[model samples]
Target: MIKLSGVIITFNEERNIEKCLQSLVNVVDEIVVVDSFSTDNTKRICLKYNVKFIEQKFLGYIEQKNFALGHASNNVIVSLDGDEALSEELQESIITLKSNWQFDGYYCNRFNNFCGQWIKHSDWYPNKKLRVFDKRFAEWKGINPHDEIVLKDHRKAGKLKGDILHWTYQSYSEFNAKTEYFSTIAAQAYFEKGKKAPFYKLIWNPFWAFFKAYFLRLGFLDGNNGYIISKETGKITYLKYKKLRKLYSNN
Candidate 1:
């Protein structure tokens, strides 16, 4: 059977890191954690497992992940966030692939938990992520705070059978706080890339964001939590463009 290295990036992930590590311990050959020198019990907790934990500066999401990938001893990799764990089925699927490895990479649907409830629809459910791959063919790409794996030279990936259990948010307050934080980072990235936030987008984009998630994507099927999620989904877009406009106006 082939071995897999599980790579993860973290910063003050004390509240969630342990579960993340526990889920990975059985599936991967070795867990490589690249931490951002958190002043919490993060490091101590990680050491409890057989992990090759490395501490580094708090680079952006994409950068730090690539750094961790570089530290991995194996070419085949299984990546996860500090707040995410593999569902039992996903863990089993990965185990099967260890012996019968296929495809240049693999895609898995993410099942996100919000406020203790599992969101089944909207932009959250079946959230496809290419987290397992042969590192030589694929690498991390996409914008800051929204990184994705992009296989080189238009390579295609196959889908796996289970979900990446994402403990996305424990409370609306926490979600809102993260939304506020991500909006700024995304806006700044747009600003640096010379992307514009025209008035039309500021007006229509947020509306569309809500419409797509709440109506088109069947967010309502998730009930009250759906409305709250859809509402904030739009807010994320609104705030991003709003902040992007502010950046340009002040320039």
Candidate 2:
């Protein structure tokens, strides 16, 4: 059987770190956590388990995740956020893969829990993520706060059978707060990349974001939270471009 290393990057994740570690400890040969020197109980909780926890200052999401990958002892990497955990079925599927590894990477669907409820529909369900992979074949890429693992040379990846459980938001305030934070980060990243936010995008993209999520993605099926989520998605779209536009104007 081949060994696998689990890696995670965290900051002030005291509320969620333990569960993330619990789900990973028995699944991988070793677990490595790269934290941003959280001034919370996060350090105390992680010490309860047998994991290699290292402190680093906050780097951009993609950079920090790549940094965590470097500390992994095994080339085969299972990456998760501090708020994510492997489902039971995914755990079994991964255990099976250890004995007969195939393909360069594995992609899995993520089920998100919002405000203490499991979201079955909306812009959240069927959330596909490529989290398990061989480090040699893939790297983390994309804008800050929205990074993804991509394989080099367009190599084909296989699907794993199970979902990743993500506790995304605990309250409306938290959701809104994160949306504001992520939109600002995304805008800054875009601005730095010399991407412009044209007037047309600011006008139409927000509406499309709402319509697509509520109607096309079936956000209404999730009821109140879905409506709120769809609207928030639109807000994020509007704010991202709005912020980006401001950045260009000020310069």
Which has the greatest TM-score? 2
lDDT of 2 by residue, 60-101 (tens): 999999999999999999999999999999999999999878
* Clashing pairs for predicted structure model 2, backbone only: none
Q: Give candidate 2's TM-score.
A: 0.98
- Candidate 1's C-alpha lDDT? 0.92
Write down the worst ten-residue block by lDDT for model 2: 114-123
Number of colliding residue pairs in each model:
0, 0
Model 2 clash tally, residue pairs = 0
Candidate 2, residue 238: Cα displacement in angstroms equals 0.3
lDDT agreement with native, every candidate: 0.92, 0.93
Residue-level lDDT tens digits of model 1 in 38-85 = 999999999999999899997888888888889999999999998898
